[model samples]
Target: MARHIYVHNPFCARKCPYCDFYSVTDNFLCEEFYKAAIKETELIGSVITEDAGTNPLTDPDGKDTVYFGGGTPTVPDSRYICELLGAVRKAFNIASDAEITIEANPSSVTPEKLTEYRQAGFNRISLGVQSLDDEVLKTLGRLHDSKGAIEALKKISEAGFTNISSDLITGVPGETLDGIKRDIGTFKELGVKHISTYSLSIEEGTEFYRRYSGNIEDLVSPELERSMYHGTREYLQKLGYETYEISNSALPGYKSIHNSSYWNSCEYFAIGAGAHGFLNDLRYGHRDDVRAYIEEMNTVTYDTYKAFLEGNESFLKSLYVEERLTREDKMREVPFLRLRTTDGILLDEFKKVFGVEFEDVFADAVKTNLEKGLLERKERTLRLTRSGLDLANIVIEDFL
Candidate 1:
């Protein structure tokens, strides 16, 4: 099992209407909560290293990935960020080549901050440059405009950071195909190493959902959204970026190590308000309320938290409520996540992990999807075809 750490910064300058991630602005608590986060991370790191004993920090095979993700990791003061990174360094026997990533919003980062992040342990920066068009930026309620994004990209490169990834939002309301193409063109010119593009979804309780419920007519049509996905894939491929996952494109050897861990069913630790962690066959999330998390931290013992981590199976079942998955569910989920990558999943590997032959288990569902031209089997690996990529949810649901 791989050991990874994720530090979630729950502070944002302001929440985007479409965002449902745990975040707040009016009562920003970075000053009050950051130190507690560092302490939590120190405790978690000590546990992981203690479990490893004298061995290398990496699993026996030597693979470890650490990530700093957020509501704007750069929103807090640089010294606090450095202190948190320092804690990880002190508590864990980190591998020399450990991949350390920090997700930054364009508006929150400056040249000095990028330099400071580099001087600290972070080697990769994932910028949140949602869109390149001014109108789209306004509609999304992003704090930064296209110019700010461009400047940040330039600064990241200038600051001597070699691995840089950016986030792009597709199918935003009022966005045109040409506008998305322009954004891609801009990314190419900026020489970014990786790109993660996602189609906008309206989550319940978000402003987008509210407007959609009220019959808002400006959102992209389903057909147009599909077109955007296809167009973006083709354009990125032409620009020499490899499509590693459904929404991720990277230059050779620049894939996101931290994110790939989750897709590959590896375990990682999370720290901060609303932060989540998966380890020892368990998953756990901290309280979303910042005050609650801080107060609980003051009273909870590490052993109690360990016990809570052990209760993950029940917690996940309760959280998903009506949609509890079974053995057949594992059969579907294993392939569904694996097929998201271009490399796909090895049939033998799936069997090794799940204790059942892949074909013997889901032959009917596989055959149906293959006949529908949504799936393809190659060299003992089954994966989604180009058509399947667009209709992925529908195809994945067939097995469920």
Candidate 2:
């Protein structure tokens, strides 16, 4: 009875230099990966059914969101995608109006493929446009240029998808405020309903880190980064896109339901290599190795799932690394997560879950930030002020 499900496809056409997500170039194993996903779904259904009466994570209703995130979910054959969706519906009770989304690269998807995907029950598409500049696209190792990205968006529209989201990155080497403005313009020109903007972070193993390790200022000045963020926020706001979450902006009624579930700290079921899930207060991740996943899942049988439900965690342990959250950890997580949204933290919900008043636990920190003009409290909600958003990580650290 998880409210959301995230299925990770661990294959990409080619790896982006700045990406650290688990993925491989192996397209040959797409069918095998889908099979593994189906098996995992069955295992989850068994676990939830057994614990339905007592598990806090299992809701009595049904799942309302399903996200096919990836290494490019569309890069594989569409038939596999359909099979996975079919297996998911069979394994869980899906709400009729559920939001089913898939992440795709501009170059990897075609109008015909998208039409097939739409037929398979995928109602939303998130394109990895990254940037609207050709040079920036090259710097980020994207396969499509600005023109190609726009054409893909056109085709997606032609394929009957109105809920389209574009992902863009800021603080790239040599990015300018004018460049960000142009990107936002491109999103509007393409009629995309949702936008997700992120600042570039040079991970240790990425090529960007290897090349520009200590010379980040040569990429984009810190002052310029700040200006670009504010500029993009202001411009998108003027264009009628609301910043519902720190990095997400959307037109009215176009917000990402799958992503909002995460910020709300809702329980979800995750499957496939490198996917993560939070259930019954335990957060867990699957093995990152694709071959290991396929081989292990091949050994799984119906009895194995039954064994897992009977307090035997050996099979589950072999497939995933699990962490059980403590009460303190859960409390610290709620405020920070809710603050990421425009609706902010709800006091009554916090009290219901933690059995204590919100102010009683965070009075000093809340008062300090409020005095500093970084946080604002409405009747039952508290959220970051405009000035606090860019430094959100810093403000949320107090809660942790």
Q: Model 1, range 96-181, lDDT digits (tens) per residue?
A: 68888988988888888888988888999999998999999999999999999999999888998889898889988888878877
**What C-alpha lDDT, on a 0 to 100 scale, does residue 150 get in candidate 1?**
95
Per-residue C-alpha lDDT of model 2 across residues 1-400, encoded as one tens digit per residue: 3457899899999989999998999799988889988988877676666333222332323348889998899899998998898788767766678889999999999877899999988999999998988888998998899899989999999999989999989998867778888888878888899999898888988877788888765687767788888898899998889989989999998988788777767777778988887766767777788888888778877777556534345775445537667888888887778888888888887887778988889998899989989899999989999888867888899888
Task: Give the lDDT of residue 263 in candidate 1.
Answer: 64
| Candidate 1: regions farther than 4 A off | 49-62, 312-332
Q: List the residue pairs that clash in candidate 1.
A: none
Off-target runs (Cα >4 Å) in candidate 2 are: 50-63, 303-313
Rate residue 397 of model 2 by lDDT: 91
Return the top candidate by TM-score: 2
